[model samples]
Target chain A: MKNYSNLNLMNFLTPGPSQLYFTVEDHIKKALKENICAISHRSKAFQQIVVHTISQIRQLMNIPEDYYIVFTASATEIWERIIQNLSIENSYHLVNGSFSKKFYDFSVSLKRKASKYEVALGQGFELADLPIPEQVELLCLTQNETSSGVSMPLSDIYELRKKFPNAIIAVDMVSSAPYPDLDFSQIDTAFFSVQKCFGLPAGLGVWIFNERCVEKSLALEKAGISTGTYHSISSLIKNIKNNETPETPNMLGIYLLGKVCEDMNRRTIQAIRTEISYKAGLMYYALRESKNFEIFVKEEKFRSKTVIVADVLQTPASTLINHLKEHQITVGSGYGAGKDKQIRIANFPTHSKETFELLADLLIKA
Target chain B: MKNYSNLNLMNFLTPGPSQLYFTVEDHIKKALKENICAISHRSKAFQQIVVHTISQIRQLMNIPEDYYIVFTASATEIWERIIQNLSIENSYHLVNGSFSKKFYDFSVSLKRKASKYEVALGQGFELADLPIPEQVELLCLTQNETSSGVSMPLSDIYELRKKFPNAIIAVDMVSSAPYPDLDFSQIDTAFFSVQKCFGLPAGLGVWIFNERCVEKSLALEKAGISTGTYHSISSLIKNIKNNETPETPNMLGIYLLGKVCEDMNRRTIQAIRTEISYKAGLMYYALRESKNFEIFVKEEKFRSKTVIVADVLQTPASTLINHLKEHQITVGSGYGAGKDKQIRIANFPTHSKETFELLADLLIKA
Candidate 1:
């Protein structure tokens, strides 16, 4: 591996905690000047922050009015909450990679009857033949699998919603939020951590759930099942109604997230998504033309636009990763089983067009 | 209310989320420059950060060799984790104020047989007369009740330990960590949020547990009981053994915390505690000499040195708070029922001696 003694100038291309937005430093400085981190969570000023944040997120994501936005520590916490609050006995998960598999394991850890339809790694799901159990109260779908660089298309998500109409459809948009243009009216819930697409620090998770999920949580509570404690859906709703959180939250993260969402809104989500497609195309083209690399996902439509995974053909994955690292550019090694044979590159909004062009130049030369 | 548009130059005195340490800005800037927030959680670099942070905390707090440090979203989450992992059916809580009461409620929410010994808002526990149920597996104690500005003395903690030898003693030091100077060997577990005395931004919690707590958690898991999902004690321990987290944690917070703890180590925890005492003395003297104010905790021995609460004698609490706000200094209102009747002032390490002297001068004339 290359020594990173001068890594202060490096740019990140890792998946999830990808890159910090150019605006984050200034917003964080403003947060310090305003004493945003010092004020009480119960203060009127904080309530305004929370209200404005939720409103900006709703506007940016085009979230429905019936949907409620709640905060968690991370998206992983949301997985456990879904199992605890939304399902009493059984839940079905469509797992294609590490993160989705972890969600499935969370359900099983909670002693719930968790059944999964898992495909081979680096493969996307075809919802047409998925079996829906009548006893499964919740169906989990990972819209974008970060580990394998495979994503279930938005149309597939809508199809799953139509087929499992009675089940609460929870989408893991941990790495794909604010870009997927997901319809909130169709899915019961979706969650994303801010570190990914939002280009903020890693601390806060946004959980958007409709009234049906809340009703399920309430029903579970009424039946004397333990949904959760402070972060239970009922507790979160009660606090959010008053524009408050049950505990002292990551105030700085929330402030920066709101500011970033406002920035994204000003830039227009459609424009951001368009740029993402262009950058992803640049990355995929470079990989296809490179003599030493190939795209991991077999189907073109299933390949992720955000996190791009590539298989090393003529050299170890580390050689290419270290070559980039030597230039103060950082991307992720393939996750889990693909650690040595694959490399995952992030195509986030923060990775500007110029940076992708530079990376493409490097890839093509190799 | 005073318009705080010009408040950027002021200091904060609110209990917790109260004040940012002077060093935080430069540390955060360095974090950004180093791309600390964007690194993969599974990387060797991130693992080194976690190991260094835990080491610094252990050094600063004089943590025993057998103790293990873990991270959470906030200290409030630790309350739920304690009930889930350590206790099977019964737990005992000593509730004096809102935060402690909330912990008791968390146990009840999980459908555990939770029993609490309640006291008036500002009163401390008298362990001598408290009865311990033989069936209780966990004993919940709050060292510093942030809501009421009352604290259980360190002596009381030791006394309770001797009396309930078989029970796991869980202490909530949310607002008084690294200041309480508790002997960890006597307690099974203790927790605090970094936004408090650590003087960092909110988003991360520090949970310190001994080997016995781990054993209990594993025992519960082995007995076919659901301890928790991802953040269960067993899961946390499993990950910590690898110097990693069960999920993607607040990476920036962990980095900043390690930096702050190193700074604290340089200043020495003893010196920090000494200054906290001096500032508390200054604030208490101001309240005692003033004709309109008095300390809220009736017992001097039980008064918290970190968070000082004062009853407004001839004016509403907001009057004094607004007076300070006009000068661009922020203080906390009395919590819950005391909201309008009292003022809570923080005597954290970040609040300098000169600021306290200035506020003292103003209070003496009021």
Candidate 2:
């Protein structure tokens, strides 16, 4: 951790698209001025970059050859898309935390005959704990919950697959995909946003779907249930194969994402994940030392290696939050009913050691 | 357009995040190296920058004092949000082109009762001919149809306000807002994506709503209709006011937008608009001179000041398109059914004079 005495004024700790990479920025500018912006999406020129980038993403994630990466908007939009395309009458949703619950709720709202398998918050899904139904066609899980700071083990998913060979498995890896340990081959599909692990910006949603999901999407499209308005998976796949998008894509964001992916490939997700673990550990150690503060999640297995959630045990959460704010150390307040009870410190890979140290020092003072 | 003879291969002409700015790229590099990616949205430091940028957007657009400028994923999301939040059972959509038709179709699919006033494909909305419905709570129009290369007149919108005082006027200025001469005072609300006129990357949506729309959003929230899952206006407003977002905000995109806005303000929109007009004129003249080309939009008033659409009257559109492609000249193929017959050229302020001439020269080669 760097000394708190001299730090840049801009660093704050929220999550997703909350950080910017300078090289990615420069790449965007160079592309713009070079007249790259004037090229048509349908032309061979644009398609190659898009196609190449997808290959890079797949290889980086160690995705199986059978899977294809499809880009969407936020992972939230994917909820509807998933329901529209993949969810048949009976699907099982494994709900462990806030985001997972939201996804389950959406499936219910869509009136899909879905069942929820609820686990304690922060106690992520375990293969043995899953309720395998006779008629279940698909299983949904969140690899990590951004709000609850939970990361489920991949083994849990593989175990489910082992027991239910016919059931299609889908994972929300918005927060988890950025970490190096995420292997896309274990599940039928994994989706995430660039804001979290990718550390670029928001607006674009990224997904990797195995051949099974693609087939499922085609089946849904053929059945007349449209899972897309502008963000259709089938249409996206067709365009992506050609290094293009069906509609006007967020060009700058995608271009920046390409640069981010290139950089990530160079640094490797392993090195980045190591750095993230170190930062989260520093914050964890700092919280553990304080009698007034306690970590929000109870289980070590479920704790997020990226986003750290801590609750103020002695002082009123708001008071401790206010104290930190006075020192210009910004952190996330609790969401929903947990307000004023917990604080979230996001350890994005883009953050420097000095920034983490400064934040740790501020928390100690508070 | 820079002597395609000497240029490298590859081109992209999608509407936004269309290209990167060199200066913006440099700034991104500086931002990344400082390990400054860890900035928090609610921190005073980041909040100040966001607030300032929003203020700048407001000022640049000459938005009314009562309206608020906020950001979202893309204007596409905003389209759904507007209908879900503000449509009070009935809306009158002005369908002059493809985009307007798409918006109307979306509203209809949502099971909302909406009426449409159609203009010819190349024509703009004429206030004198429009029907003012007393039951219609919102009047929707697209200032520029990127697909058809048509731009509606701002003066017509102002005139409609005088006649339809009870109805709120909402304009999709996604293509026109970034250019000059957008009179915000006459309209109640306007939405734009950062990728187009703003000259930033895609992923960020900017919408300025009047007091009436805000009240409508509040009313919907009170009524308990899920305003929208991710595209809710109420959530966006709350987040923006907090210097936060309903979901993880796209920080990198917004940061780049802020930089782009600064550069825009330096030159001013009027100056940029002038350059755009100059380029448009050159292209229009070139199309007029071409042996096989004819302007698709018949009337001068109906033509988009920003984009030009030309129909290949003699040679097949693809033949000419492929010929241009061989030279590494990238331009748009028409959307939907017009794909085989027309080409669209966009002349943003950033496109240099030499670029326009080169494109013209290439067309003249046939």
Candidate 3:
């Protein structure tokens, strides 16, 4: 533990828990002796904290009056639970990139009648490209593709809503929420990991569900599908309604989440988005001059302003990344198909010009 | 944060992160700077650390050289992953209590053909009462039933191993791993939450798998029943072989876990087990004299030496528990079936005689 503190070199560039706030870390240490361990998950005090935090999140998201937000392990865990609970008959998943494709595959793995309307990589799934659903039970989309560093055109979701009036639409905003233009009213269920834009640790995933989705779950329960006993939507609903979780949660992470949320509310989500845009703006401009680099996802308008995906030109990305690593700088490799051809640079809100410039200098030197 | 250190009344009695060592908490705080935020899961340094930890855990558990260990979110998450990854054809789950029942239900939910041999609450599982499978793919057992405070007789497992040589056996030792008799050779996979006996936070679950289970997973892969791609047994195998996780792990938790392992290594497992026994003995004797208190689980041999479950004889357990709360003493409630009927007194190694005396005095007055 002591040696790690003295290392002085090493950078964490992979997305999420972008960087821990010293204030929050200190707060958790102080909380260690504060009776957090002995309290039952079902206790009124702990329940009140859960309720308050959920309510605070709802306010932050500007969720619809009828919507409810619940917490889970991570966005990935919710991916599985969504299939286990909400897929009653069939699920129509829209796949534009790697992450959404994984979701579609997960649904199929669960033996659900799942179909996908996929667009080519570096392309957005236009409303025209989505197939007409025959009795669609759930509509799934990744609002922001963390893997591809792209955000779906918001208008496409609105267009889909017009076609499937009764379908329960679920969106993954793991990298989008706590950013701008994330309207919660249009979707039935939206999930995000608090670690990304929220700037907390990797443990908690926040899920916001509309009344329609809740009704569908109740209907499924009445019909005896049972969904599941643990990760079921109904069980989550009950826990949220009572302001508690069914099991003991990752309390420290949740506590830090509350702190992160409080900090965000003070700073404003728009400010964070503006900061992300600034970082991306600086990075996009710097990478353009380097003949060895090119952005992967085609349209700049649809590309994620928070995460920049760049393709390597002459040199292998590994070489450039290793050059940066020599200076104790860190960045991520492109996921899946983008692999060696691309590199991902996350411009988290807390990341500063000094850090971004440090990377730019290294890339230029390389 | 400073106020918590100054305050004399704060007592963290919750299940986990029960109370972090000051040094452990400080290391995490300092790591949040620029170092950890940039480290990659694929880095050789991180991989080596992971390998070292796994090797240490193997040595501590007395695991055979061929067996391996994998890490997960929590022991609860492993319950689902275990049945999903290992159960190929049929499984026999011995459900003696809540945690065991939940594991059985999860198997059934996964569409796995599962059989349950259950015993009444507070009574530990006996091999004689369970149906010995003619051909079992895997056997599931929870060594320590946290909710009911009963540990399935270890002798039963030894006897079953002799009678059923081919069946792979899995055990949930979340609340029992800190103490003795963790012979990994007899069991196929033994999992535990780091927060329990490990005395850390609740993010990591340590799973030790036998060579047979690994072979079976590979066979299942060849037969096309690959556990979901992201959660494949092969990914875990690759990770364990290299001493790293396939995904981004809780690095801070891993550091704390290493510290815990070092602390445990300072004293032999027998010495640590003795301390646990000493603390449990203190709590048991304190409760023995109270006319209104009786052990929740009947047999002393089957009792969890780490967690004492005591039922209120003539009064509501919650009422007495609430009385103790005023004095800043914290204790857990009976989980699942024992809810409202029993008080759980955790005999964590760090908890001393002074802590026990405070609780005993409060209970005597109440």
Give me the candidate number with maximum TM-score.
Answer: 1
What lDDT does candidate 1 reach at residue A188?
A: 96
> Model 2 residue B216 lDDT?
86
Q: Put down candidate 2 lDDT per residue, A287-329, tens digits, no spaces.
A: 8876767888787777887778888775457787667656655
Interface RMSD of each: 2.7, 6.0, 4.6
Report residue A288 deviation for candidate 1 (angstroms): 1.3
**Model 1 chain A: worst 10 consecutive residues (lDDT sum):** A1-10
Instruction: For all candidates, state DockQ relative to the true structure.
Output: 0.63, 0.26, 0.29
**Residue-by-residue lDDT tens digits, candidate 1, A4-102:** 235668889889788798899898888877778877788888888898899999999999988999899999999999999999889999989999999
lDDT of 2 at A66: 74
The better candidate by TM-score, 1 or 3, is 1
Give the per-residue lDDT of model 2 (tens digit) for B1-366: 133223334333334434444355565654455433455455565576677677777667677767877877778767766777787587889897788988887677455788999977777766767776766788888888988888877777788888888787889988777774767767778898766666555667888887788888778667655455555676677777776665656666666677777777888877877888887888888888878788888888878867788888855578877777676655677767788888877666555667678888887766
User: Which prediction has the highest DockQ against the true structure?
Assistant: 1
* TM-score of the B chain in each candidate versus the native B chain: 0.97, 0.91, 0.91
B88-173 in candidate 1: lDDT tens per residue?
A: 88899999999999999999998889999999988987766687786579999999999889999998899888887999999999
Question: What TM-score, over all chains together, does every model reach?
Answer: 0.98, 0.78, 0.88
Off by over 4 Å in 1: A1-5, B1-5
Tell me candidate 3's TM-score on chain B.
0.91
